[model samples]
Target chain A: MNVFLQELRSQRRSTLIWSLSLAAFGSLYLLLFGAIRNDISAFEDVLKNFPPVAQAALGFVIGTLKTVSGFYAFAFTYIVLCGAIQAANLGVGAIGREIGGSTADFLLTKPRARWSILAQKALAVLVLLVATNVVLLAVTIPVAAAQGPDFDAGLFVLLSATMFFVQVIFASLGLLYGVAAKKVKSVVAVSLPGVFAFYIVGLLGAVVGEDAIRYFTPFKYFDIGYILKNAAYETGFCLVAVAVVVVAVGASFAVFAKKDVQAL
Target chain B: MNVFWRELRANRKSLIWWCVGMVLMIYAGMAKYAAYATSGTSIADLMKQMPASLSAALGFAGLDVMKASGFYGMLYLYLLLMVAIHAALLGANILAKEERDHTSEFLMVKPASRSRIVTAKLAAAFVNVTVLNLVSLGLSFAVVEQYAAGENMTDEILLLMGAMFIVQLVFLFLGSAIAAVGKRPRSAASLATTVMLVTYVVSIVVDINKNLGFLRYLTPFKYFAAAPVLDRMGYEPVFVVLSALIIVASVVVTYLAYDRRDLKL
Candidate 1:
């Protein structure tokens, strides 16, 4: 645990940068939301005019754009993209740097089990992700409140909580890529394509009106819009997100444990 | 030359993966076409039913909505923008990775002149992009011929492909030159990526908002309009000339910078 804490301390700068960036994206969305707050009816008119297929493709559901949560769902993809990039950058560098610098073997020689080292590094990444999401929530909540009392606080809280789990799933994806790829550059290749594929699947489903394909995209499970409307997540997607974390993290540990290392 | 060849060969898997990915998108596109074709509605009719706003978002103005070539124009531009960026970055980074790997000293110590070494590396990067583009084009045509047969083809489709191919070459060569001059490979990669991304954003913003039109001319991406290219009017000679000048200037700058610089890694 001390080693895990130490790793977190070592990553303080990266953590701060990611946290600030996530907050910035959240703040940008909120600012835009505020700009349009006075003219909700005009916005509704725009949404109403969209073709159903196009609306679905863009996740611009009718009658939802006026609510804070609705706006959140509308802008969720951009925020998630930013968050996912943060997690991917962390995963690519965290382990690969140790290997690149020839410090992995030296670290392994310490009074630590391989599992402990892996666990601690993973914990550091998780903490960073959580901290970023927390900062995002911290800023977004007050902004939502300032908008109106009718804002669904319960749904807002639930959506924010889901972001934590969402980040973990994506971070684990990055870690898995880190473990499997031989070079750090390959980590970005894996994460970017993987995220894009999921997004594309979600889009395909939305455009084709096929709920079945939605199951393939993590975005569908999170359903920022649904959570905002119902104050809860899709139960099945929550389970899938948890399952993804368990499988990816377990697989990453298994791979990292056996990989060859050289000491500086 | 040997080192360049080595890096190019090492990237074979990546090249193959990229080719397959693009071909798969084309397949998906053909599927979209098939769905429309089977509905007994002519391509023009189906397209006419699409909402004006949606068509605007999808970049359909001045494009034939009913033809295979038109669909290709609408979809291929976005896909190729992304693919070409990937290819350019890959081409640039692989050329500089030897230094990043601390193997540049071994490679650079050969009896060949520094200019020859740099030229070989740049040549290899060019060849990589050229081959990838050719493969993607070949696969796209194959799919168009086999699946979307008897469709009205346009000169615009050819021009679109040609413009994208040239754009890929410019970006790849420009990025390679930037990489060669930079002291750190990671910095080089970041710089190249940032430049390309900023250019794309500028180009898009300019197109979407008429107020930003004046800023468009500054970005290399704005040189070839998707509408014009898809219309098969051929590239504006001015843009082609500008791209060539930029490519030549970048190459010269790289050669000058690298000739005097020392490799530390």
Candidate 2:
């Protein structure tokens, strides 16, 4: 418990940065909502002014804006992309840094077992990520509530929780890479583009009709659009993400325990 | 040349993935556009179909999906932004990789001068990016030509693709400069990613609200107008030239800076 607290404190700055960034994103969406909330009719009138050719260029039909579904379609796509990037970035250096600095040995050499060190680090980072999502939801709920729309708080919470799982999955995957790689440089170099490629695959899946491929991306499991509309969790997808995380983390510690740690 | 070849060799997988991913994304985008194309839906029809809320969300106004440029505009622009981000990080990390790996001392003790080494590394990074872009563009063109071709595909698309390449080049060099100047490899990568992401976010917002027009200038992306390029068959050569100047300055400054930098990793 003491060790966990110490590690948490050490991670506070990164946690704050991450939480604040997510908060800022939530604020941006609120601002988007506010724009329409101010004068819904006026906004519609402005849309009417654009030429048809100009209008088709935007992609979405304006009539859908009358419902929350409309907002989910357009805004959630960007939001999911942003959130995925955040998750990927948070994971990229989290495990790689510890392994890269050769501090895993020092940490493992302590009174605790090797598994404890890995578990504690993973939990700490996951907790930070989950905390950030909580802030995001806290900010979002009030703004959504203020808009005279009966918001589904449960759906929102579930969606936010899914974000935590998404982070865990990526973090575990990154940890696997960090543990396997011979150097930190190679880990980061390999992981950066890998994250973006996954994003592209997910985005393509979403745009096209590849529901199967969407399942491959962590983003698909905690889909913002689906949650917003259904006001419920997608249980099967969430389970898949969790199962993957558990497997990856278990594999990571197993590998880390045996691998030769070259301390700098 | 050894450094150049080594970088190319090391990055072969990345290069392949990026190119393939870009091609796949572009194909998906054009396929979406083709759906609209078949309906004989003028850009206006597509606009009318758009959810008012969605328009606000995507920040789309005066967008016509019918025009090839418009189709590419809605479809390909974001991909270009993604490519640029990838290119920037590729430039930064690849250049500083040896130093970050704690191999700089070993390499620096070799026969080559630091300047030559830096130059070769930069040249390798540039070639890698160029190949990635060319292949992405070529593959996209091939896919578009093969799978779907009904609308007027013009020189504008070629021009837009070219401008996008230039913007990508600028991002790469900017990343290289940050890598050279940054204190840590992670810091360098973070700075490059942040700059690219912020610029992209600002570019989206700036286009949404022209009152913040000045912010667009801050993003290297703002210089290329794919719509105008696709529609007019050419873009402002001056902007292309300006972007080139920035790329050259960034690469030159970063090379010089890295040469004199103490290997402190």
Candidate 3:
């Protein structure tokens, strides 16, 4: 209980920054929807002139750039990118900082069991992430509706909710990396590359038109284009995301329980 | 001189990893171009098939993306991203690592002056980015040419790489400037990367919304946009002057800030 609260309190500043940034992107872009809608034909011509490959790389979808939901869904890719970084940072820092900062000795010597410690840390990250998503939803949904087009409220919620789903998957992988690494000198170093590698994987998969490759990268699990059409996520990918969380979080506990903190 | 060589030797392993990573990235990226080139459709027609939604999404598409130059021009955006990140992290970490690793005292106690050390470390970072740039240039030449199908796209690739070098230099100095000015040694790299990301987002937003075209001044990415540079338009003169200003200012800031700060230890 103490560790959970302490973790939340310690991480309050970064959490707030990430939440605000996420919420800001949602509001800022949707507000622009009105201005852009007035000049749709001109905007379409400009988009046509931009490179196709670059468009795919930026997660732009051609079929839906005209609508509010579609535009926000497109902008939501950048949001997901940011949220993944924050999640990865939080997860890696959860246990990695204790070992890296050489504070594991003091923390481990306390009376709590190792599993209990891990549980509290994981729970704190979950709470923080949920709070971020709530803040994002609260800001984005209302602004999106106010754009006055036929806003698909249900679909917008579905698309926005994927932020949490992606965050959970990355956070688990980050935690596992945190526990498995011998000692981490810098949390950003580990998390940033991991996030970018997956991102590029998703981008390349789109470039090659290879749907099978999507399974390898979490970024592909929630396709904004597909969701814009089908109004749902791929069942297979969602299960894969769940499996990843289960395996990674489970492995973190197993390794962390037996690990010797004194060796570092 | 010893400080420069020592910095090079210390950064050797990571540079090798960066090289390997760049090689794979180029290969993977060019592989897409090869697939596009041979798909039995003339590159021009294939591109014609792709809808001009970006015009719908934001502005004008002028490049003939079916050509080797056009495809490579598109690919350069991704390359710019990688190099920008490497330069930013390299610049921030080169100085800040000493403090983070608690070796600032050991280095500061050396016979060299603080400016001399900064120059040496920055020189090493210079070499690192140069090698990475050349590696990209060489591989881009090889792969983009393969798909060039005898069109002689070398000049196009060179122009793009040249622009890429300037972008890398801008970010490297920007990173060093942030590290030198920041109070916390550990947060220097994060701050540098954050600055890099914000500018990148600004560039993207500008690309998507021409109304924000004024923001081109704020980001290095817009200074030499791939499509414009590859189109024989070349780097905009105004952005060229801005890049130069940023580089010179950052160098001055780094020297002035690092010289006066007390060592963390």
Candidate 4:
């Protein structure tokens, strides 16, 4: 409990900064949706004329620009990317930095079990991620509502909820990398590549129009367009997301338990 | 001299990885272009039916995707982004790792002056950035030729690569300057990445709303946008001057900051 509390307290500043930035970014983009809302035909024409490669270049996938959910979906893609980065940073720094800096001697020597310590750390990250999603919704909802009269409240909330799942997936993946590497010189080194690689893979998958390719990258796990149309997630990808989290977190625990901690 | 070689040797593996990634990116992108050319399907209609929410706005204006250079111009956006990222991370990592890994004491005790050391590190990073650029250029020319159906895209590719080079230099120095001046050496790489990504997002936002055109000056991504530059077939004079100023200013800052700072060691 102390470990959980300690970890949470330590992470408060960054967590606040990240969540606020995500909210602010989304709100700012959502506010601009008003300009596009006034001209549905013109905007639809612009989208029709725009090339897919150019859209992928700008990281601007997710369409239906004429509708509120449509525009929100466009902004939501980048939001998810940022959320992934935040989760990756937290996860890698939590485990990798502690062990790499040789501070694990102080941590692992405690009377508490290793699993307990890892659980507390993981729990803290999860709780903070939940807080990020809440802040994101709280700030963006009113802004989104102001722009479109037909704002689907339930749909908005459901879309916002997937951010938590994405964060969980990235955080778990980061934890896996945290323990798997022999020595982590920089957390950013591992986390940036890991997160961006998945993102690029998703972009490439979209370009090639490959459905099976989506299975390989977590960033593509949720089809925002499908969600907006069907009002639900694809069960197969959802299950895949769940399996990823379980296997990643499970392997982290197993490798971390018996692993040698090199003395500094 | 020794520091330069050592930096190169240390980064060799990662450099190889980056090179391989670039080669694969070019090959994959060109392969898709080839498929589209031969498949006889309309891409715009194809995009709409596959998933509307997958992509909407934020695109280059006035390029026929059917043309070979047009497709390469689109691919250039991602290439510029990837190369710029490599430059920034390399710049910061080279400078910060000394203090970060607690080797500042050893490095500082050398007979070489701080400015000389900074020069060496920056030079090593410059080499890394250039090598990546040339590797990208080579693959791009070959791949475009194979798929371009006899269209000569070499001149346009060369121009785009030149613009990309300036971006790489600007970001490399900006990153090194941040590391040189920042109190938290550990955060330098993340900070640089954040700055890079924010500018990229801002560039797209500008695309979404032309009212934000003024903000173009603030982002390097817009400085040499593939569509405009390819159409004009020349670098924008103002952006070229701006890039030069930034590169020079950042180099000055790197020297001054690293010289005066107290090593965390």
**DockQ of the candidate models in sequence:** 0.17, 0.35, 0.24, 0.26
Shift in Å, residue B149, candidate 2: 3.4
Query: Could you give candidate 3's per-residue lDDT for residues B84-203 as a string of tens digits?
Result: 888998999899888877789999999999999999999999999999999989998877777777798777778888999999999999999999999988788778888888887787
TM-score of chain A of each: 0.83, 0.78, 0.90, 0.90
The digit string of per-residue lDDT tens for model 4 on B168-248 reads 998999999999999988888888887888888887777666777899999999999887888889988999999999999
The residue-by-residue lDDT of candidate 1 on B1-265, one tens digit each, is 5867876787778777767666666666666765654544333543454443334333564466456776676667566666656655764576566766677788778898878887877777777777767776776677676545676454555666677777786777677777777777755665575567557656644543445578866777777767666555777888899888877887887788778777767
- For model 3, residues A100-202, the per-residue Cα lDDT tens digits are 7778888888899999999999999999999999999998888888988688899888989999999999999999999989886677767776787787776
- Any residue pairs clashing in model 1, and if so which? B156-B232
Best by DockQ: 2
- Choose the strongest candidate by TM-score: 4
Model 4, span A17-109: residue lDDT tens: 999989988887888776655555444455565566644532233346666777878778889988998999888877888886668789888
How far residue B185's Cα lies from its native spot in candidate 2, in Å, is 3.1
lDDT of 2 by residue, A1-264 (tens): 554676678668856776676666555655565455444455556656666655554423444454444443455555556665655555555556766656656666789876776677777767767777777777777766665565555655565566566667777777777766776664435555767667767767635576787677776777565665577767888778878888887888888778877777
Q: On residues B1-265, what C-alpha lDDT tens digit does candidate 2 reach at each position? A: 8987887898888778777878778877776665656655454554555544445355544456655456666666777777787777887887667776677788888899888887887788788888877876676677666434575554545676777788888888899898888877656776787788778767666654455777766787778765556555677776777887888899888978887886775
Which candidate would rank higher by TM-score, 2 or 4? 4
Candidates arranged by lDDT, highest first = 4, 3, 2, 1
Misplaced by over 4 Å in model 4 are A42-63, A206-209, B35-58
TM-score of chain A of 2: 0.78
**TM-score per candidate, in order?**
0.78, 0.86, 0.89, 0.91
Which lDDT tens digits does candidate 1 get at residues A1-264? 876787788778757866775665565555555545544554444545655554454344435656777766655555675566557666665676566545667777899887788888898888788788778888888887777777887777776676677667777877777766665643344455566556555546423655786667666678765666677778887788889889999998998888766544
Residue-level lDDT for A116 in candidate 4: 90
